[model samples]
Target: MTTAQKRSDVPHAALIQMTSGIDPQRNLATIEEALGEAAAQGAAMAFLPEMSVLLDRDRERSSHHISLESGEAWLRAMQDFARRHGIWLHTGSKPLLASDGRRRLNRSHVIAADGSLRAHYDKIHMFDVDLPTGEKWVESAAFLGGEQICVVDTPLGRLGLSICFDVRFPELYRRLVEEGAELLAVPAAFTVPTGEAHWHILLRARAIETGCHILATAQEGQHEDGRATYGHSIAINPWGSILMEIEGGESDEKDYRLALVPIDPVATKKARTAIPLSRSRAARNITL
Candidate 1:
């Protein structure tokens, strides 16, 4: 593990909300610009939205863009970019061909300031759903579900990684908290209906129950692939308070949006000590 350069007792983190398109080059440019800006604002780490590199739903079109993580030039460039900027980066999630050579995976990469991969977590839950708005997503059909949970140390804290659909499963967050995760990352590209109805509620519930800071960088606006996503990327504190948030919706104002939130380890400790949810769980041995 690379030693995290602690800049301050309380570090600030950047949350990037993007309108990523099908072209990987264009998306890379957008993220590069955001990373520079985040570094300029004195952020120690930047968290990007899911599918930061490519967002096309068309299997044939997106298949060509998906490559092995080791051979993916775009990912390497981003790592170099992180090293150059002297900041850590959590690449919300990227689509990559699985090592098995048959299926794809929605994977999140955590790159240290030295450009070394600290950890990578493939999204365990697939967003296979049929929305009320006549939209359907069969993520399991295209991507293989991951089996392991990833929790890693960073400049901010021990981060528990999860993707969009995984947010709905509270058991995952509980297990993450049990593993001593101080922060949880739930990068997503959620549909409008689901986002409006359940996004904030679910995020707050997770934070409150686990007593961990929640950072949900998101993909917003309409994409080149004809899909629209709910925006409003947000950061929630351990007490379920909204620390920072960006606007939601399609706009011609900018290609992306950014916000920096302070991550206070003191708050995490206080919340956990006050509630003691873990102890309560230990007091009971009931299974559902």
Candidate 2:
């Protein structure tokens, strides 16, 4: 058991970058390994990249594995892993059986250090676009978008949950910050082209605009489905500074990529005081 009862004065978030495959079990192995390492290092929480547990472009065959009914192994394993390690886990995103029962949704789950389910956010913005690289994504066809913006309270800080495509929308971040979110989680399986063009810049912009610490974990390298994902998982401070990032290429299992970020509430306060964007919102009526 790697659960640490003592809290560090300053929390360190472990941002994990993984190149996930088709097998959910294999991906969970990597996640458990990363959790052990993170707990050993005294990390306050661990944020995994999007599709960290499973990435299968094929909806039909993938459903057999990705679909989670009550009492599923993958979700149970994840919760138990977090509990045994005594660490908070921000799952990047996974396909889970929705309330409708017939469909699934891309959901980000927050498991507390005590191994209880704290909160969950469904991906609000869908990836429905045709990229310049000739790769097309119709996320809407497979999963439904979430209508609510979710912010949850935690020991480290208030957390705002969002998926890959949501990073493009500044309004979401602003709304989250307005709701007292000091930290933003962006777990993505971004395409290589879009990620190269806008990933870092967009993440920094969100952090600067919202006055929050942003952790964008991501899927890197090509997957079993032949789709290449942009993998440059990073952590940004409230002042829009890249504190740390992944250092190696895709599929390098020899070197586990984890960036340690200080969760600074003082920096968030200072940034908000300096900018005062919330006080100066163009639309005073928009709700999160």
Q: How far is candidate 2 from the true structure (C-alpha RMSD, Å)?
A: 3.8
TM-scores for candidates 1 onward, in order: 0.95, 0.92
lDDT of each: 0.90, 0.84
Best by TM-score: 1
> How would you encode candidate 1's per-residue C-alpha lDDT over 114-217 as one tens digit per residue?
99999999999999999898988899988999998989999999999999999999999888877889999999999989999999999999999989999999
Off by over 4 Å in 1: 1-9, 249-253
Over 72-164, each residue of candidate 2 has an lDDT whose tens digit, in order, gives 677778999999999999989888877776667898889998899988899999999998879889988888889999999876799999999
Cα-based lDDT at residue 166, candidate 2: 96
